[model samples]
Target: MFYFFSLDFSLVVGIFLFFLFIFFFFLFIYFFFFSKLVIMDWEIMSFNGFDIKFTFLFDWVSLSFVSIVLFISTSVIFFSFYYMMGDVFMFRFIFLVFLFVVSMLVVILVPNLIALLLGWDGLGLVSFCLVIYYQNFKSLVSGMITVLANRVGDVMILLSIGWMVSIGGWNYFFFDNFFCCFWVMFCVCLAGMTKSAQFPFCSWLPAAMAAPTPVSALVHSSTLVTAGVHLILRFWLFLSNYSVVVVFLFFVSSVTMFLSGFSALFETDLKKIIALSTLSQLSVMLFAISNGFCLFGLFHLYTHALFKALLFLCAGTIIHCFSHVQDFRSLGFCWSKIPFVMTFMNFSNLALCGFPFLGGFYSKDLVLESFFFSSWSIFFFLFLFFSTVFTVAYSVRLTLYSMFFMEKGFVVDNESDSEFFVVFPIFLLGLGSIFGGSFFFFLFFVDFSEFLLTSFFLKILIFSFFFWGSLLALWLVFMDFSFDKKVFINYFFYYGSSMWNLQFIFSQFFLNFPFFLSFYYLYKLDRGYLELFGGKGILFVFSWLGNFFHYISFKSVLYFFSFLFFFMIFMFI
Candidate 1:
């Protein structure tokens, strides 16, 4: 039943995606080649009194993004058949994924805040379901954190919706002076940051890895994380004018990139490392968008989705084969057994490192090179540079741990590449990892006139980080830097492993503290004072009143009979 259901769903969505991809690919070409701009908005419905409409926007950005999303989602659905083969609730899982895809599409296609929230809220609601699919305590906690953090964004969007009411309608594109609404822009940016797992809301991304690997591939790559970037991209015209917000966004995103990359270096869990990298790449996209590199940011968003999805899928296969062990330290030389999966894994790892000509290189190079000539400060430039360096270092570290080191852990000899469902989807994404960047580069960067001309050294500045980062990785891998000093090790672990204490500060302090207070209040107030004075006290008061009334009624009946008897004796006399 599961196989049949999965196959049918894949076939249907695949055909639909194929035609959509071709249509949009040509549509993009038509719009770009002819140097024409077109935005087609269709109103599905119109309410009477208030005059609100359900509208869909079809433009080059929406079309292209929809195509990419469809492609990735279809592939993920197909891949889930293999990854989730043994699950009893395969049907539910597949449908949830499909619903997630629909929600993402809704978010991508709708321009109006009202309609966009429909999709935005759907993404959050469905993600909560998918994250806690395992039904365990860890998954539940992760799901709560993920949903609560995103709820902050949802509230912002809701506030933006309410703010938009003053302007007659919720279509932000209709008004040119939307930037004048400072609170609205603030809400939009905050919503995007929370959705994208920015510096403040980043703990959820790593925590969300408790979800199924397939969910991670889809959510972290295309749908949920990128939704924020897409939101900011749509509102860039208004957001760009807010200089203070833009500078703050730049700072936040740069710090996010650095912190996430740095944390990935100390991360031992395979899935958490990849999750942190996703957070880092997301920061890159937001940084570009903040710095007015929306074109490069959009380009990078597309390419990063392809490679990151591939990386997660590859990681999924490895984890599945290795008894679900996600620690790289416990895994080594996996290529010796599952050579084919490992081969594709390397392709994704290299792509993530932004190797020349791969999918990531085109966007990463464009964003970095453009930044070099921009008027931004040198401090952020260093932060981003080191972040890029850390990216490569961690990529190399991941490779060494998984490919070069001796097989130090348990071996499952039953691993094989015979699963057609597994290899086929991976092969498709692998091809994208190899050529998706170049294809997207031509389509998107046809006219990079805004990129200032720079010297040769400046041209390869981003490329040079790869070399230095690799050297750092090599030193860290080969050197005996293990510390015997307990305090130093504690501090190192505290800073590195805890993401500069963001996990505790944000997760434990900000979120968990409030939750703890609630629990304490439940114990001290609801279970203590409120329980006595409120529920139990009311019950006791009612019970006492009932007894008092019964005794009064009995006394009244006896007195009435005595009075009647006395009246009857007087009448007889």
Candidate 2:
């Protein structure tokens, strides 16, 4: 039933994504570990003072990041075989997935701003199409929100392109020596946030759970949302030259990390919680970019994608089996329903929490170690430290609340993976989530000096945050801690759950006002006022004048004039 088109085509494309992943991985290993480096450029336009070109700067950063994207996309496509096995429009969905991957590749490959927009806008457009694939009210609304939010980024990119004219061309790297164009880089960073779903643009990420799970796996995990961090990393050369932009980016990203992490704690819906987790991880990448560790950010991005995509897929597997039970409150004892899914879920959540030797461990540890040595402020360290703790807290809470307890709606089903298409892809990704970090760590960081350089206390403190956070979560959930009334009653929890009223401001206040204005103009001006004054009123005046002219014809006027003239002449005589 799924084969609207040739299944062979899907298999070929899926294999290709994996092939590209391996190809890039080998290339990255040679470049970073060995002596050979591959820096290829394709020029398209040459003009006054600058040329518009497509340049793939295949340093450790781009290659590694793109490898991660391709790897995750490959797995997502494989997972989709089971997820959409019987869907009528499976062909359309796969096509969109392929297109989305292509667009992301465009974003990843290009260094020029104008050329980059081709991919950037492509990601936005394709993501919108994918999000509304379900064609329901929720999907339509979510897709509209996604499009409008991404449009802000799309518009900013166009503005960035316009601003680049002052710098001679869209090739930002060419201006490395004369890096005074903060505004240009600033525009790019601003655009990045919208794509990355930072802060104000964040509501769309969770709302986009309305999309199919495979789309979520690709869109949230690696391709669409990561475009922002990828763009910022590409522009890091210019961004690092300006402290103001860095400060602004740092502030925004730190708050985003905290906010999303906090919000995940409040979220009950399984998919939405996973979506918020993606937001937090995206923020971490943004924060790393702001600190001028763009390469380090890229490393985290790579590792995060490995696990987060798997997490989404695992959630999809369970959601598929359960059908409608996405709420953790009612989804208790999932460990009983599918022990294997429970295993995948726990591993992913643990990876997300940066458990030792997992995919997240290597990158998260490096990023944290780097932060301590960077000599940033104590408050900065605190915010970051606590954000990590928040990650652990919520991850633990999610696991315990969903797995450890037995609720009224709990079901116990022992389903084997013999017929499940997800098993292979999930197992492959699970392997990546465990070993990809260590594997990439060799290609990523040459100097392990940073790891040993930090003080023992600082390292302990970092791990302590995770330990304490996890313990507190266990206490809160398992101890009958009255989490619902106590936390929900508090302002922070309430605010966090409501996503800090950001939805209210965006959806109700900002969005509604524009809609109100549009309605008023459509009804009051175009239909009513304009119809009366511009269309109907003008027609009425012309018709009345025509009638008046018709009543007094030209010949009748002449006869009346002649009679009046004769009468006047007789009177005068």
Off by over 4 Å in 1: 1-52, 178-180, 413-416, 447-453, 479-490, 521-573
Segments of candidate 2 deviating more than 4 angstroms: 1-8, 34-54, 177-180, 407-416, 450-452, 475-492, 522-573
Candidate 1 Cα lDDT to native: 0.85
Q: Please report the candidate that would top lDDT against the real structure.
A: 1
What range of 10 consecutive residues in model 1 has the weakest lDDT sum?
476-485
The candidate maximizing TM-score is 1
> For model 2, how does the per-residue alpha-carbon lDDT over 1-573 read when each residue is reduced to its tens digit?
447463655677789888988998888767666655455678677889565567665666667677888888888888887788778788888889999998988888777778788888888888888999999989988888888988988888888778667667777666765544776777888899999999778888888999999899888888988888888877777788888889988988888898888888777788998999899999888887777676678878888888988898888877777655787766677776677767877888888988989989888887787776576798888789878888998898888877877655634334534335577788878888888888877755556764436788887887897888888677656534564566435665568788888878775566787878999999998999889999899999999988766655664887667767888999999
Pairs that collide in candidate 2 are: none
TM-score of 2: 0.86
**Each prediction's number of clashing residue pairs:** 0, 0
Candidate 1 TM-score versus the reference = 0.88
Error of 2 at 79 (Å): 1.0
